[model samples]
Target: MEHVYIGLGSNLADPAEQLRNAVQALGQLPDSVLVGVSAFYQSDSLLPGQPRYTNAVVALDSDLAPLALLDALQAIEIDQGRERHERWGPRTLDLDILLFGDRLIDEPRLKVPHYHMQARPFVLYPLAELAPVDLQLADGRTLKALLADCPFVGLERLPH
Candidate 1:
Protein backbone atom coordinates (compact mmCIF):
# COMPACT_ATOMS: atom_id res chain seq x y z
CA MET A 1 0.00 0.00 0.00
CA GLU A 2 1.17 3.50 -0.80
CA HIS A 3 0.62 6.43 1.51
CA VAL A 4 -1.65 9.03 -0.02
CA TYR A 5 -3.08 12.36 1.04
CA ILE A 6 -6.28 13.81 -0.28
CA GLY A 7 -7.48 17.35 0.02
CA LEU A 8 -11.23 17.91 0.38
CA GLY A 9 -13.13 21.14 -0.09
CA SER A 10 -16.70 22.36 -0.48
CA ASN A 11 -18.48 25.65 -0.60
CA LEU A 12 -22.01 24.84 -1.64
CA ALA A 13 -24.89 22.97 -0.03
CA ASP A 14 -23.81 22.95 3.58
CA PRO A 15 -20.08 22.80 3.11
CA ALA A 16 -19.21 21.10 6.35
CA GLU A 17 -21.78 18.40 5.78
CA GLN A 18 -20.44 17.90 2.31
CA LEU A 19 -16.94 17.31 3.66
CA ARG A 20 -18.27 14.90 6.27
CA ASN A 21 -20.07 12.91 3.61
CA ALA A 22 -16.95 12.90 1.41
CA VAL A 23 -14.88 11.61 4.30
CA GLN A 24 -17.30 8.74 4.80
CA ALA A 25 -17.17 7.89 1.13
CA LEU A 26 -13.35 7.99 1.19
CA GLY A 27 -13.33 5.49 4.01
CA GLN A 28 -15.23 3.05 1.80
CA LEU A 29 -12.91 3.18 -1.21
CA PRO A 30 -11.85 -0.24 -2.49
CA ASP A 31 -8.33 -1.43 -1.67
CA SER A 32 -7.77 1.63 0.48
CA VAL A 33 -7.79 2.33 4.17
CA LEU A 34 -8.63 5.76 5.47
CA VAL A 35 -6.01 6.48 8.07
CA GLY A 36 -6.18 10.04 9.31
CA VAL A 37 -8.25 13.20 8.87
CA SER A 38 -7.39 16.72 9.92
CA ALA A 39 -9.73 19.21 11.56
CA PHE A 40 -12.09 21.08 9.29
CA TYR A 41 -11.26 24.66 8.34
CA GLN A 42 -13.19 27.47 6.74
CA SER A 43 -11.29 29.59 4.24
CA ASP A 44 -12.05 32.27 1.73
CA SER A 45 -12.57 31.02 -1.77
CA LEU A 46 -9.85 31.46 -4.37
CA LEU A 47 -12.13 33.67 -6.39
CA PRO A 48 -13.92 36.61 -4.88
CA GLY A 49 -17.71 36.68 -4.48
CA GLN A 50 -17.83 32.99 -3.71
CA PRO A 51 -18.89 31.44 -0.44
CA ARG A 52 -16.24 30.37 2.06
CA TYR A 53 -15.03 26.81 1.64
CA THR A 54 -14.83 24.06 4.23
CA ASN A 55 -11.59 22.13 3.88
CA ALA A 56 -9.71 19.20 5.35
CA VAL A 57 -7.04 16.64 4.50
CA VAL A 58 -7.23 12.87 4.72
CA ALA A 59 -4.54 10.21 4.75
CA LEU A 60 -5.05 6.90 3.01
CA ASP A 61 -3.04 3.79 2.36
CA SER A 62 -4.13 2.27 -0.92
CA ASP A 63 -3.11 -0.55 -3.16
CA LEU A 64 -4.90 1.01 -6.13
CA ALA A 65 -2.87 2.59 -8.88
CA PRO A 66 -2.69 6.40 -8.99
CA LEU A 67 -4.98 6.86 -11.97
CA ALA A 68 -7.45 4.37 -10.60
CA LEU A 69 -7.49 6.21 -7.31
CA LEU A 70 -8.06 9.49 -9.12
CA ASP A 71 -10.98 7.94 -10.97
CA ALA A 72 -12.52 6.77 -7.75
CA LEU A 73 -12.15 10.23 -6.21
CA GLN A 74 -13.81 11.84 -9.21
CA ALA A 75 -16.61 9.35 -8.98
CA ILE A 76 -17.16 10.32 -5.39
CA GLU A 77 -17.24 13.98 -6.36
CA ILE A 78 -19.85 13.28 -9.02
CA ASP A 79 -21.91 11.23 -6.60
CA GLN A 80 -21.89 14.21 -4.26
CA GLY A 81 -23.25 16.57 -6.95
CA ARG A 82 -20.03 18.20 -8.08
CA GLU A 83 -20.23 20.25 -11.27
CA ARG A 84 -17.33 21.78 -13.14
CA HIS A 85 -19.26 24.77 -14.40
CA GLU A 86 -16.31 27.15 -14.09
CA ARG A 87 -12.73 27.18 -13.06
CA TRP A 88 -12.34 27.88 -9.33
CA GLY A 89 -16.10 28.10 -9.15
CA PRO A 90 -18.08 27.08 -6.11
CA ARG A 91 -18.95 23.43 -5.75
CA THR A 92 -20.64 20.89 -3.50
CA LEU A 93 -17.46 18.84 -3.24
CA ASP A 94 -13.91 18.98 -4.55
CA LEU A 95 -11.43 16.17 -4.04
CA ASP A 96 -7.81 16.56 -5.02
CA ILE A 97 -4.95 14.12 -4.89
CA LEU A 98 -2.49 16.18 -2.91
CA LEU A 99 0.21 13.56 -2.79
CA PHE A 100 0.44 9.96 -3.93
CA GLY A 101 3.26 8.27 -2.05
CA ASP A 102 6.67 9.72 -2.95
CA ARG A 103 6.05 9.56 -6.66
CA LEU A 104 6.19 12.63 -8.88
CA ILE A 105 3.57 12.08 -11.53
CA ASP A 106 2.64 14.20 -14.53
CA GLU A 107 -0.22 12.86 -16.57
CA PRO A 108 -2.48 14.79 -18.90
CA ARG A 109 -5.35 14.32 -16.46
CA LEU A 110 -3.46 14.34 -13.17
CA LYS A 111 -0.51 15.90 -11.38
CA VAL A 112 0.86 14.71 -8.09
CA PRO A 113 2.38 16.98 -5.41
CA HIS A 114 -0.58 19.07 -6.55
CA TYR A 115 0.64 22.16 -8.34
CA HIS A 116 -0.42 24.91 -5.95
CA MET A 117 -0.44 23.11 -2.62
CA GLN A 118 2.72 24.63 -1.21
CA ALA A 119 1.18 28.08 -1.09
CA ARG A 120 -2.35 27.34 0.13
CA PRO A 121 -2.78 27.45 3.89
CA PHE A 122 -6.05 25.57 3.67
CA VAL A 123 -4.02 22.78 2.12
CA LEU A 124 -0.78 23.15 3.98
CA TYR A 125 -2.03 23.56 7.53
CA PRO A 126 -4.36 20.60 7.46
CA LEU A 127 -1.66 18.58 5.70
CA ALA A 128 0.78 19.50 8.45
CA GLU A 129 -1.59 17.93 10.93
CA LEU A 130 -1.51 14.55 9.24
CA ALA A 131 1.93 14.50 7.61
CA PRO A 132 5.21 13.85 9.32
CA VAL A 133 7.38 16.72 10.56
CA ASP A 134 10.08 15.65 8.14
CA LEU A 135 7.76 14.81 5.27
CA GLN A 136 9.32 15.58 1.93
CA LEU A 137 7.56 16.05 -1.37
CA ALA A 138 8.74 14.19 -4.42
CA ASP A 139 9.94 17.54 -5.70
CA GLY A 140 12.51 17.83 -2.87
CA ARG A 141 10.53 20.33 -0.80
CA THR A 142 10.02 19.52 2.84
CA LEU A 143 6.63 19.83 4.48
CA LYS A 144 8.15 21.84 7.32
CA ALA A 145 9.66 24.29 4.85
CA LEU A 146 6.40 24.67 3.03
CA LEU A 147 4.56 25.38 6.27
CA ALA A 148 7.13 27.99 7.13
CA ASP A 149 6.40 29.74 3.86
CA CYS A 150 2.63 29.37 3.97
CA PRO A 151 1.21 30.86 7.10
CA PHE A 152 -2.23 30.00 8.39
CA VAL A 153 -4.08 33.04 7.19
CA GLY A 154 -7.65 33.68 6.10
CA LEU A 155 -8.64 30.39 7.67
CA GLU A 156 -10.93 29.56 10.54
CA ARG A 157 -10.80 26.19 12.31
CA LEU A 158 -14.32 24.94 12.94
CA PRO A 159 -15.33 23.06 16.03
CA HIS A 160 -15.28 19.28 15.82
Candidate 2:
Protein backbone atom coordinates (compact mmCIF):
# COMPACT_ATOMS: atom_id res chain seq x y z
CA MET A 1 0.00 0.00 0.00
CA GLU A 2 1.09 3.55 -0.73
CA HIS A 3 0.77 6.49 1.61
CA VAL A 4 -1.69 9.06 0.35
CA TYR A 5 -2.89 12.36 1.72
CA ILE A 6 -6.18 14.01 0.78
CA GLY A 7 -7.54 17.45 1.54
CA LEU A 8 -11.27 17.70 2.30
CA GLY A 9 -13.58 20.64 2.50
CA SER A 10 -17.27 21.47 2.51
CA ASN A 11 -19.27 24.65 2.68
CA LEU A 12 -22.87 23.45 2.52
CA ALA A 13 -25.32 21.34 4.49
CA ASP A 14 -23.66 21.22 7.87
CA PRO A 15 -20.13 21.80 6.78
CA ALA A 16 -18.36 19.95 9.56
CA GLU A 17 -20.69 17.00 9.30
CA GLN A 18 -20.24 16.99 5.56
CA LEU A 19 -16.49 16.77 6.00
CA ARG A 20 -16.89 13.93 8.50
CA ASN A 21 -19.17 11.99 6.19
CA ALA A 22 -16.75 12.39 3.31
CA VAL A 23 -13.95 11.00 5.45
CA GLN A 24 -16.06 8.03 6.49
CA ALA A 25 -17.16 7.48 2.90
CA LEU A 26 -13.60 7.61 1.60
CA GLY A 27 -12.62 4.78 3.93
CA GLN A 28 -14.99 2.42 2.14
CA LEU A 29 -13.48 2.76 -1.31
CA PRO A 30 -11.73 -0.27 -2.72
CA ASP A 31 -8.08 -0.89 -1.92
CA SER A 32 -7.99 1.83 0.69
CA VAL A 33 -7.69 2.17 4.42
CA LEU A 34 -7.93 5.48 6.24
CA VAL A 35 -5.00 6.05 8.55
CA GLY A 36 -5.57 9.49 10.01
CA VAL A 37 -7.81 12.55 9.84
CA SER A 38 -7.02 16.04 11.06
CA ALA A 39 -9.20 18.39 13.00
CA PHE A 40 -11.99 20.29 11.30
CA TYR A 41 -11.37 23.95 10.54
CA GLN A 42 -13.71 26.70 9.48
CA SER A 43 -12.17 29.06 6.99
CA ASP A 44 -13.19 31.96 4.81
CA SER A 45 -14.35 30.74 1.45
CA LEU A 46 -11.69 30.72 -1.21
CA LEU A 47 -14.40 31.28 -3.79
CA PRO A 48 -16.30 34.47 -4.23
CA GLY A 49 -19.82 34.61 -2.73
CA GLN A 50 -19.50 31.21 -1.17
CA PRO A 51 -20.09 30.32 2.46
CA ARG A 52 -17.33 29.45 4.90
CA TYR A 53 -15.73 26.05 4.43
CA THR A 54 -14.97 23.35 6.95
CA ASN A 55 -11.64 21.92 5.92
CA ALA A 56 -9.55 18.89 6.82
CA VAL A 57 -6.89 16.50 5.61
CA VAL A 58 -6.92 12.74 5.75
CA ALA A 59 -4.07 10.24 5.52
CA LEU A 60 -4.48 6.81 4.04
CA ASP A 61 -2.81 3.63 2.93
CA SER A 62 -4.09 2.68 -0.48
CA ASP A 63 -3.35 0.33 -3.30
CA LEU A 64 -4.93 2.52 -5.98
CA ALA A 65 -2.72 4.38 -8.40
CA PRO A 66 -2.82 8.18 -8.55
CA LEU A 67 -5.39 8.42 -11.31
CA ALA A 68 -7.49 5.75 -9.70
CA LEU A 69 -7.38 7.58 -6.40
CA LEU A 70 -8.41 10.79 -8.11
CA ASP A 71 -11.37 9.02 -9.66
CA ALA A 72 -12.39 7.63 -6.32
CA LEU A 73 -12.25 11.08 -4.75
CA GLN A 74 -14.38 12.54 -7.51
CA ALA A 75 -16.88 9.76 -7.03
CA ILE A 76 -17.13 10.69 -3.38
CA GLU A 77 -17.73 14.32 -4.26
CA ILE A 78 -20.41 13.33 -6.73
CA ASP A 79 -22.00 11.13 -4.09
CA GLN A 80 -22.18 14.21 -1.88
CA GLY A 81 -24.02 16.24 -4.55
CA ARG A 82 -21.01 18.25 -5.62
CA GLU A 83 -21.31 20.01 -8.94
CA ARG A 84 -18.45 21.79 -10.61
CA HIS A 85 -19.96 24.76 -12.38
CA GLU A 86 -16.95 27.03 -11.83
CA ARG A 87 -13.46 26.98 -10.52
CA TRP A 88 -13.40 27.25 -6.70
CA GLY A 89 -17.17 27.14 -6.71
CA PRO A 90 -19.36 26.15 -3.80
CA ARG A 91 -19.10 22.49 -2.94
CA THR A 92 -20.95 19.97 -0.86
CA LEU A 93 -17.62 18.18 -0.60
CA ASP A 94 -14.18 18.70 -2.08
CA LEU A 95 -11.30 16.26 -2.08
CA ASP A 96 -7.76 17.01 -3.20
CA ILE A 97 -4.90 14.57 -3.50
CA LEU A 98 -2.10 16.28 -1.63
CA LEU A 99 0.56 13.61 -1.72
CA PHE A 100 1.00 10.12 -3.09
CA GLY A 101 3.99 8.30 -1.63
CA ASP A 102 6.51 10.93 -2.73
CA ARG A 103 5.92 9.75 -6.31
CA LEU A 104 5.51 13.33 -7.64
CA ILE A 105 3.09 12.55 -10.41
CA ASP A 106 1.79 15.14 -12.86
CA GLU A 107 -0.81 14.29 -15.46
CA PRO A 108 -3.72 15.81 -17.34
CA ARG A 109 -6.22 14.56 -14.78
CA LEU A 110 -4.21 14.51 -11.58
CA LYS A 111 -1.26 15.98 -9.71
CA VAL A 112 0.22 14.24 -6.75
CA PRO A 113 1.66 16.41 -3.96
CA HIS A 114 -0.92 19.00 -4.83
CA TYR A 115 0.39 22.25 -6.19
CA HIS A 116 -0.37 25.31 -4.03
CA MET A 117 -0.63 23.02 -1.03
CA GLN A 118 1.76 24.82 1.30
CA ALA A 119 0.29 28.13 0.30
CA ARG A 120 -3.08 27.31 1.88
CA PRO A 121 -3.44 27.29 5.64
CA PHE A 122 -6.43 25.00 5.42
CA VAL A 123 -4.35 22.37 3.65
CA LEU A 124 -1.22 22.71 5.73
CA TYR A 125 -2.90 22.74 9.14
CA PRO A 126 -4.69 19.48 8.67
CA LEU A 127 -1.96 17.71 6.72
CA ALA A 128 0.47 18.44 9.51
CA GLU A 129 -1.82 16.74 11.96
CA LEU A 130 -2.71 13.68 9.92
CA ALA A 131 0.80 12.92 8.80
CA PRO A 132 2.41 13.45 12.18
CA VAL A 133 5.13 11.03 11.27
CA ASP A 134 6.30 12.91 8.21
CA LEU A 135 5.48 16.47 9.37
CA GLN A 136 4.72 19.12 6.73
CA LEU A 137 8.01 20.25 5.26
CA ALA A 138 11.47 19.18 4.29
CA ASP A 139 12.55 22.42 5.93
CA GLY A 140 12.54 22.78 9.70
CA ARG A 141 9.39 24.90 9.99
CA THR A 142 6.19 23.23 11.21
CA LEU A 143 2.66 23.39 9.89
CA LYS A 144 1.51 25.26 12.98
CA ALA A 145 4.40 27.66 12.58
CA LEU A 146 3.68 28.22 8.95
CA LEU A 147 0.07 28.82 9.86
CA ALA A 148 1.07 31.36 12.51
CA ASP A 149 3.42 33.07 10.11
CA CYS A 150 0.70 33.42 7.49
CA PRO A 151 -2.27 35.76 7.61
CA PHE A 152 -5.10 33.22 7.77
CA VAL A 153 -7.00 33.09 11.03
CA GLY A 154 -9.47 31.05 13.07
CA LEU A 155 -7.77 27.65 12.91
CA GLU A 156 -8.74 25.30 15.72
CA ARG A 157 -8.04 21.62 16.34
CA LEU A 158 -10.95 19.26 17.06
CA PRO A 159 -11.56 15.62 17.80
CA HIS A 160 -13.56 13.27 15.56
Candidate 3:
Protein backbone atom coordinates (compact mmCIF):
# COMPACT_ATOMS: atom_id res chain seq x y z
CA MET A 1 0.00 0.00 0.00
CA GLU A 2 1.18 3.47 -0.85
CA HIS A 3 0.80 6.23 1.68
CA VAL A 4 -1.15 9.21 0.35
CA TYR A 5 -2.15 12.58 1.67
CA ILE A 6 -5.41 14.26 0.71
CA GLY A 7 -6.34 17.88 1.13
CA LEU A 8 -9.95 18.79 1.89
CA GLY A 9 -11.67 22.14 1.68
CA SER A 10 -15.16 23.57 1.68
CA ASN A 11 -16.80 26.95 1.84
CA LEU A 12 -20.45 26.29 1.06
CA ALA A 13 -23.20 24.45 2.92
CA ASP A 14 -21.80 24.24 6.42
CA PRO A 15 -18.12 23.97 5.57
CA ALA A 16 -16.98 22.26 8.72
CA GLU A 17 -19.69 19.64 8.50
CA GLN A 18 -18.79 19.05 4.88
CA LEU A 19 -15.20 18.19 5.85
CA ARG A 20 -16.36 15.87 8.63
CA ASN A 21 -18.59 14.01 6.24
CA ALA A 22 -15.83 13.81 3.67
CA VAL A 23 -13.50 12.30 6.25
CA GLN A 24 -16.06 9.61 6.92
CA ALA A 25 -16.45 8.91 3.22
CA LEU A 26 -12.68 8.60 2.84
CA GLY A 27 -12.52 5.96 5.52
CA GLN A 28 -14.86 3.81 3.45
CA LEU A 29 -12.87 3.84 0.23
CA PRO A 30 -12.12 0.43 -1.23
CA ASP A 31 -8.57 -0.93 -0.81
CA SER A 32 -7.78 2.10 1.32
CA VAL A 33 -7.24 2.70 4.99
CA LEU A 34 -7.71 6.14 6.46
CA VAL A 35 -4.79 6.75 8.79
CA GLY A 36 -4.45 10.29 10.10
CA VAL A 37 -6.36 13.54 9.88
CA SER A 38 -5.16 16.98 10.88
CA ALA A 39 -7.11 19.56 12.79
CA PHE A 40 -9.55 21.66 10.77
CA TYR A 41 -8.43 25.10 9.74
CA GLN A 42 -10.15 28.18 8.37
CA SER A 43 -8.42 30.35 5.84
CA ASP A 44 -9.29 33.35 3.73
CA SER A 45 -10.42 32.52 0.25
CA LEU A 46 -7.76 32.68 -2.45
CA LEU A 47 -10.10 34.90 -4.36
CA PRO A 48 -11.69 37.92 -2.79
CA GLY A 49 -15.44 38.16 -2.14
CA GLN A 50 -15.74 34.48 -1.37
CA PRO A 51 -16.43 32.96 2.02
CA ARG A 52 -13.47 31.78 4.08
CA TYR A 53 -12.75 28.08 3.61
CA THR A 54 -12.51 25.19 6.03
CA ASN A 55 -9.59 22.87 5.26
CA ALA A 56 -7.77 19.81 6.58
CA VAL A 57 -5.43 17.05 5.48
CA VAL A 58 -5.87 13.30 5.69
CA ALA A 59 -3.42 10.43 5.39
CA LEU A 60 -4.32 7.17 3.67
CA ASP A 61 -2.63 3.94 2.77
CA SER A 62 -4.12 2.57 -0.42
CA ASP A 63 -3.44 -0.14 -2.90
CA LEU A 64 -5.36 1.71 -5.64
CA ALA A 65 -3.47 3.27 -8.51
CA PRO A 66 -3.00 7.04 -8.58
CA LEU A 67 -5.54 7.72 -11.30
CA ALA A 68 -8.05 5.45 -9.67
CA LEU A 69 -7.60 7.27 -6.41
CA LEU A 70 -8.08 10.60 -8.15
CA ASP A 71 -11.30 9.33 -9.68
CA ALA A 72 -12.54 8.29 -6.28
CA LEU A 73 -11.80 11.68 -4.77
CA GLN A 74 -13.56 13.48 -7.63
CA ALA A 75 -16.55 11.23 -7.20
CA ILE A 76 -16.68 12.07 -3.51
CA GLU A 77 -16.64 15.76 -4.37
CA ILE A 78 -19.55 15.34 -6.79
CA ASP A 79 -21.48 13.25 -4.31
CA GLN A 80 -21.19 16.13 -1.86
CA GLY A 81 -22.65 18.71 -4.27
CA ARG A 82 -19.49 19.87 -5.93
CA GLU A 83 -19.92 21.81 -9.18
CA ARG A 84 -17.42 22.60 -11.91
CA HIS A 85 -18.51 26.06 -12.88
CA GLU A 86 -15.40 28.16 -12.29
CA ARG A 87 -11.72 27.91 -11.52
CA TRP A 88 -11.15 28.00 -7.77
CA GLY A 89 -14.71 29.10 -7.21
CA PRO A 90 -16.56 28.45 -3.96
CA ARG A 91 -17.81 24.93 -3.64
CA THR A 92 -19.58 22.44 -1.40
CA LEU A 93 -16.37 20.41 -1.18
CA ASP A 94 -12.89 20.25 -2.68
CA LEU A 95 -10.77 17.15 -2.28
CA ASP A 96 -7.28 16.88 -3.72
CA ILE A 97 -4.66 14.14 -3.72
CA LEU A 98 -1.79 16.13 -2.38
CA LEU A 99 0.86 13.43 -2.33
CA PHE A 100 1.06 9.80 -3.35
CA GLY A 101 3.77 8.14 -1.32
CA ASP A 102 7.16 9.17 -2.71
CA ARG A 103 6.07 8.78 -6.30
CA LEU A 104 6.07 11.67 -8.75
CA ILE A 105 3.05 11.72 -11.00
CA ASP A 106 2.39 14.11 -13.87
CA GLU A 107 -0.85 13.01 -15.42
CA PRO A 108 -3.06 15.20 -17.54
CA ARG A 109 -5.87 14.89 -15.01
CA LEU A 110 -3.83 15.00 -11.81
CA LYS A 111 -0.50 16.11 -10.39
CA VAL A 112 1.13 14.61 -7.36
CA PRO A 113 2.65 16.73 -4.62
CA HIS A 114 -0.12 19.04 -5.84
CA TYR A 115 1.36 21.74 -8.08
CA HIS A 116 0.69 24.65 -5.74
CA MET A 117 0.84 22.95 -2.35
CA GLN A 118 4.19 24.35 -1.29
CA ALA A 119 2.81 27.85 -1.58
CA ARG A 120 -0.57 27.37 0.05
CA PRO A 121 -0.67 27.80 3.81
CA PHE A 122 -3.96 25.98 4.20
CA VAL A 123 -2.41 22.92 2.59
CA LEU A 124 1.02 23.18 4.19
CA TYR A 125 0.14 23.77 7.83
CA PRO A 126 -2.48 21.04 8.07
CA LEU A 127 -0.24 18.69 6.10
CA ALA A 128 2.59 19.38 8.52
CA GLU A 129 0.46 17.93 11.28
CA LEU A 130 0.05 14.53 9.63
CA ALA A 131 3.28 14.22 7.61
CA PRO A 132 6.58 13.10 9.02
CA VAL A 133 8.97 15.77 10.23
CA ASP A 134 11.56 14.70 7.67
CA LEU A 135 9.06 14.02 4.91
CA GLN A 136 10.52 14.60 1.47
CA LEU A 137 8.53 14.96 -1.70
CA ALA A 138 9.35 13.08 -4.87
CA ASP A 139 10.54 16.39 -6.19
CA GLY A 140 13.18 16.48 -3.44
CA ARG A 141 11.70 19.30 -1.39
CA THR A 142 11.56 18.67 2.33
CA LEU A 143 8.41 19.39 4.29
CA LYS A 144 10.39 21.26 6.91
CA ALA A 145 11.88 23.56 4.28
CA LEU A 146 8.49 24.20 2.74
CA LEU A 147 7.05 25.10 6.13
CA ALA A 148 9.89 27.50 6.72
CA ASP A 149 9.06 29.35 3.52
CA CYS A 150 5.30 29.34 4.02
CA PRO A 151 3.93 31.37 6.90
CA PHE A 152 0.77 30.59 8.82
CA VAL A 153 -1.05 33.73 7.88
CA GLY A 154 -4.77 34.26 7.35
CA LEU A 155 -5.54 30.92 8.94
CA GLU A 156 -7.39 30.03 12.14
CA ARG A 157 -7.43 26.57 13.72
CA LEU A 158 -10.92 25.49 14.69
CA PRO A 159 -11.74 23.54 17.84
CA HIS A 160 -11.86 19.79 17.50
Clashes of each: 0, 0, 0
Across 49-108, the per-residue lDDT of candidate 1 in tens digits comes to: 999999999999999999999999999999999999887789999999999999999999
What pairs collide in candidate 3?
none
Q: Candidate 3: where are CA atoms >4 Å away?
A: none
Can you tell me which runs of candidate 1 are displaced by over 4 Å? none
TM-score of each: 0.99, 0.86, 0.99
Q: How large is the C-alpha RMSD of every model relative to the true structure?
A: 0.6, 2.8, 0.5
Candidate 3, RMSD to the unseen true structure: 0.5
Ranking by lDDT: 3, 1, 2
Q: Write the per-residue lDDT of candidate 2 for residues 15-129, one digit (tens) a residue.
A: 8888878989988989999998888888778766889888999989999988888998999899888999977788899999988875767798876567777678888877777
User: TM-score for model 2?
Assistant: 0.86
Q: Cα lDDT for residue 120, model 1?
A: 98
Write down the worst ten-residue block by lDDT for model 1.
Answer: 82-91
Model 1 pairs in collision: none
